[model samples]
Target: MFSLATWNVNSVRMRLEHLLRWLKLRAPNVVCLQETKATDQEFPYTEINEAGYYVVHAGGKGRNGVAILSDKEPREVTIGFPDVDDQEAKERIIAATIEGVRVLSIYIPNGGSVGSDYFLYKLEFIYRLREYLDSYFDPDQDLLALCGDFNVAPEKIDVYDPELLAGHICFHERERTAIKLLKEWGLVDTYRALHPDEKGAFTWWDYQFGAFKANRGMRLDHIWVSRKLAQKLKKAIIDREPRGWKKPSDHAPVIAYFEL
Candidate 1:
């Protein structure tokens, strides 16, 4: 079984110690990260490589960034959605082929509000993702894994209280629909597929207002797999322990195993 994981580390630099500790514990074959909040030169790739992984990143100044750290070398490493023309907006995507499986580490924009420009941008970004996947990948045949913070909860059960959070950024209709369309295109949420009846199985919580303590959270981070890869799925898990650690990221790591 090969193991892989995704995490939105908030800021890789600040959380490097925690991340290194976690890596030592889990030691997944491939790890994808989002919200690294560091430029390429500042990503601490040397430290990561010393930890037994080769790291690749697409990043800049003080915001969104994505990275891939793999025990095996990655080929065809790409930094952003090819079709999206905006080159300076934010670093949100990184992808490569590891052991024949296409691994995409993406940080989908967090829609600021229900009816805001940022919200529309988020939707368009997701749509662009769909377009990219359709153009380059065969979801039914290719062994593809999209692992990162998707920012949208694809189902009512994915949120603690869908009614209370109705039309909210991550729970909005359009956002959910975007994930719906992606799944329809032949990808499946690996966690949901395995734990169909599980509820309140969240991956993120607000650091404010004791949200994590109250168990008020949303399953924003995810590991989405193509049909062919899903068939090889062995296990999917959200490691919540990291969220309670010192200077945590407010998001947990989601790991999946497959008989690759």
Candidate 2:
């Protein structure tokens, strides 16, 4: 049995204390972190190394970053989408092979507004992501997991208030379409696969208006498993209690356990 977790730390430097506490409790075999918001020079490599894990990270100045931490050192690590053009190659994706499983950590663009340039970039990013995965498709691989903060709610059930959020960047139709395309490519959403009818389970709570207290949240963080490993999935959960912690990130971790 192996357990994997994904969390958008918001800022690794600022939340190091919180993360350390959580890691001590959960001790997941593999962890994929998003929104690290720190450069390579700024990451606390020594601290992480002391925690008994190998770290593979891709980060920028302050906005987007992704990383993977593994209990067993990965045989290989790759940062960024493989086939992306130069423009989209900025830090957003990281992958590593741990225990024979290919793990990917990604932080999708937030796409602030409907018609904004960032919004277009978000859609284009998904397109490039699909293309990159197409080239790397390997059905023979028995364990492949992609986990991250996709910055998207693929269905109305994913958000607390879908009507009010319709056409919003994260809940927009275009983004949903892209996500659906990825599903068609044979990746199963492990959480939904376990709890097909579950609801009101969310990973991200907006900072404004005391959203977490009111339970007004969205399931933006996710774990996707290739069909081969999806069958062995044991359980999946969103750790909502972390959001209640003092000075917590807007997002919490999503965990998936499997019998690999």
- TM-score of every candidate: 0.98, 0.96
- Model 2, span 54-116: residue lDDT tens: 898888886888889898988778877764555334578888889888999988899998889
- Highest lDDT scorer: 1
Residue pairs clashing in model 2 are none
Error of 1 at 33 (Å): 0.4
The segments of candidate 1 whose C-alpha lies over 4 angstroms from its true place after superposition are 88-90
All models: lDDT?
Answer: 0.92, 0.87
RMSD of model 2, in Å?
Answer: 1.3
Highest-TM-score candidate: 1
How high a TM-score does candidate 2 get? 0.96
Regions of candidate 2 where Cα sits further than 4 Å from its true position: 139-142
Task: Please provide the root mean square deviation of candidate 1 (C-alpha atoms, Å).
Answer: 1.1
- Candidate 1, number of clashes: 0
Q: Per-residue alpha-carbon lDDT of model 1 for 98-176, expressed as tens digits?
A: 9999999999899897789989989988888888899999988899999999999898899989999998899999999
